[model samples]
Target: MLIHLAYTLTGDRRCAELQRMDSERLDMSGYAYYENIWGGGAESMFRRKASVVQHLDRLRVGEHSLFEIDDFIVNGGEGPGQQDEHRRLFAPAVDLNFRRFEQDRRAYLEGGAERQADEEAALMRWLPHCRRKLFFEWNAPELVNRLIPFLYLDTYLSLLRAERSTIEQVRRDLVLGLNRAFSHLYLTDSDNLYVTTQYLHSAEQPRPLVRLTIPLSGVDLFVDGRPDMAYDRERPDLLLRFAPPPALALRPGAPMPKLERWRLNLLTFEYLMRLAHGGTYNILADECELSVRALKDQLLSAFAYEPAEAGLIEFFVAERRRYVLKKIQIDEQGHLRSGG
Candidate 1:
């Protein structure tokens, strides 16, 4: 899957020469593109949207009128799930200004609920496919595209080719293991070892959370040189994490790589897969405690050596994007073939 940004002006404007977005305000962007990672902002917040489109008078900058930006909407899908996967994505451009005056007139009638009801009825009357494009679009990721840096295209393409196999394995690991781990991380001991992705300090407390954090080297927990019985107990914001095995966990470096609180499924999958593979490929992280250095180290360590070009990276993870190896057959000699 791919995601891109589009912008348009909305809401009522009294004059032509409207102000542009401020740099500092735009700097405080709340974009969420990495579904597997929760970095506060919109991820922790609930979002609400209105279907109605906003209309504004033409913007004017000095004598000449500002460029008019029309609302654009796009919606399209293709083929069956089992087919050749000739899928296409279109963000379909639709114009919502057609009935601007009419909608305005309807706005005041009978408190406008009547017109709203009529519009809904009329939409229901039309062919279902026709209404797919009419939606009030809002994507925080797209809003902050201005702040996103461009990739070193040549270097990225080369690296993609060089590490295709590693990439494929990662995809498979994530696609198959994430949800499976989420369902079972708590089953490690059942009687103890709980995890909570919230805030609860371990410095000092009256009833301190009995959170067991396993380090990379240690297999057991000891409190004052004695086994700590992690009995089942109630504690708010408690988190039990199986910390990365030292060699596998990257140390924090400067110009830190920004990471988020682990999305539970991804975190669990990382741990379970590491256990299964007899090696760890990740580091533990807490929500609201992201380190840019750790992120940079993880990527560099994955390659064993640094590349020449500066890379631009974006995390894209979605459960719905799982892969299917359809119509494949394995030969007796351990060869693979596409059957269908």
Candidate 2:
């Protein structure tokens, strides 16, 4: 769907870019060399392409609005009895600027600090544009719901990896910003749980920790009554603490190890995956504008961390880029509906 839409809307430029991508893939060890867990064989590709073409045809003939097309793509054309493992789980098109940012970030990551300035420059230029497009220009609320979380995550990662003395101040601002934004987007079941990445320490263990803390008075969510339990204990009902997985744990009194930025991202994502699976954080959809349940479903689908593989982290980092980019593009095109 994204390929067809890009080709249709952007014309020769998109076509040239696709051709160039194909050429680059061919120049690799082989086409398969460029493929990953998120990729499909020719048959599956053709099947998706065909379905998207049909949807595009409908749009061209005024049979459906861009929102309708977006609905079909994000939700799929399946009925209740037809549910399958391959069901659509929050697939949204991201914008061109984000697409390029991913490419540039990858290059910088692989090439080391030499390209850091370029990557940072690109993000500074595009973050506002992408935000504006998602918030104001785009009308696909479903897609936007699935996407903005990631935008926040990526922005957080960028700030974390930056070499600056004001990082703590910036991080606090990010957390507060998330609180302000998510307060409007999500509602809890008498449990105000606001989840985002934070860097803090535990008294019992002075290592990097992923803590979930809720500050309910009488509700002992942990049930164990262990004061050492560093779960969500701030103001939310459940506290989920995720530390560096055992394999990545650091030694005592060691200098702060420089983690690969995406590793931090994957750890945070893994924590969210656990939260989504537990079904403890109940988001009231009717009470809010965004379908956060759908967002969680998408998060579960996109970042399922268990049943791990060798390069799962790498695959997820790449897939995250594509998923966000697709959602942005879909939302941007929502301006096309004459009455919608």
Candidate 3:
């Protein structure tokens, strides 16, 4: 029926041939009905085929006619208008089947079923490649866009067996992973834009400015000087800030570490503080070649790592500063005593 319909909609000889071939292959008795309806008169068949081919070329997977085909199967060929009734019948079955398949696959993998795991992984990988080709050939941007949401979903699913972590922690990791990937693609100096001639001109221009008001908590912490302010919400707020570079721009591959490196240094300091205290702070400062005051200011502002904290934070800052001073031999070299 679908083949005949496709043939009728598209006067494509290929579609008509496919209908005939499938009908013969299936050995269905209904082939006669299709022939009588569509293969009778030359003008009727030609006109119908032309119309059907044109329509079929425009057919999208989720559009109205698609559901009609599914409905036809579910309701045993009662046809178009009965879609609403059959949809209710089929929807639950499809959902249940998908859920069961996922559960069974997970259970098999958990039980060390290597063969099943390999098979499932192979099938999953094949599906995306097939989908990409279909979407590209059909020029279906909507279907392609639908696939984008799954990139993160798939990333999370891939990490399902990793060390158990709280949902909040996992969510944070996912956000960081996505941010890293996006930054690499869109913001990195060696990104695709730099290599492509078409994008090189655009790359030379500064990225468009984005304005974001600091959160009340952030404002209270920095502007109001409240170090005790902690976020109570499960999700951390993301703030994007921009610092326009100096007019004497550094060339590509320059040694300058930029703001991202500063942010990373602050995070590293916070992590180290959580792990230990009473270490020589001078070591860290010297390693990064940062003055004590500059390092302190950067850590405080970038990560909210307060030196006033009683235990880990204060101990960490003091020890790190001492370590920096000693390692660089700042007293003998007189390097740390002077400004850069």
Candidate 4:
């Protein structure tokens, strides 16, 4: 279904390759739905708890589970008209939940801790049934937008096992992750943006000012427009307060605004590791007609040290080698830092 949707959206025949790749990646089941469900389950649960994070096809009404409705449509002893009628029966409830979901989403974004907690609880209570709503209404513009943030948030939350974290901590992580996601989307040329703790500055004289932008690209709602980095040409001084970045101070219900070059977040690191260790990188190297070492050097430039920044990137490299490649053992302690 998703591959069909992808092909429909992009009209690219290559989208069919996703099916082939997914099949290759999975076991004899010939499908990856279960692995995806289990592998990303915590992230999905966290995103759902955080906000309404689902596409239209995934939406459910109270008590009328998707599977039940799907069965109804397939074998409800009903004709097309009857199935349409049954589907419409749940439409009002779905609409109501959508409105409420959007309202709570706005409240969570605009409200403080108390309001956020209240909304979270309300949404949690609404989950079992609201998640089961079934309908074919594609009227909601925000559905697709809601879906994107769920995946983007996982880029950060999964690394830390965010399900165990406090509400405040989860919100903080979401804010940071969303910023990282939109920054990459608006600023970089690559689809896979490598977000790192490291920062870079230009060496040219009278260096052009790079505005730190916080683009909320469908953070919880569908943003109709794209981020225009050209708009930031006026506010170069925004770089001074890069610590939190402007996304932290964005007013409630603020519009999406619009990076620097070359960053590497942990998500990208893990992906690269999997590719290299799984031999995918070697296949890519072979296909590209480039030496593996040469291919790696091209990517390594993003992690390389610049004269302006500290050696944090170097520290990351060393630690990755020690803990990952060498599996070095450290002196165990009783604290949280200690090896369990």
Per-residue C-alpha lDDT of model 3 across residues 33-116, encoded as one tens digit per residue: 223223334455443555454333332222222333322332323655444533443342222232343343344445465567
RMSD of each: 23.8, 26.7, 20.7, 21.4
Q: Where in model 1 is the C-alpha error above 4 Å?
A: 1-94, 100-116, 120-340
Estimate every model's Cα lDDT from 0 to 1. 0.26, 0.32, 0.30, 0.32
Model 3 has an lDDT value of: 0.30
Name the weakest run of 10 consecutive residues (lDDT summed) in model 1: 52-61
* Model 4 regions lying over 4 Å from their true place: 1-66, 77-169, 175-315, 318-340
* lDDT pick, better of 1 and 2: 2
Query: lDDT, candidate 3, residue 229?
Result: 42
- The CA lDDT at 252 in model 2 is 50
Model 2 scores a C-alpha lDDT of 0.32
Which candidate comes out best when scored by TM-score?
A: 4
Q: Rank the candidates by lDDT, best first.
A: 4, 2, 3, 1
Model 1 Cα lDDT, one tens digit per residue, 21-69: 2222231111212211121223222211211111111111011211111
Clashes of 1: 14
Per-model TM values vs. the true structure: 0.17, 0.19, 0.18, 0.20
- In candidate 3, residue 236 scores what lDDT? 22
What are the per-residue Cα lDDT tens digits for candidate 2 across 1-340? 4654344344323456657865664321112211211122344454354555443222122112245333333233356632231132211223332235445434544655876787667544534333333333345554444433332344344344552444434333323322322332222222222322222244542221112222222111111122334444532112222222232233355333231111223223323332333322333222221333343233233333332222111100114232110111112434422211
Clashing pairs in 4: 60-132, 60-133, 61-132, 61-133, 194-263, 195-264, 195-265, 196-264, 196-265
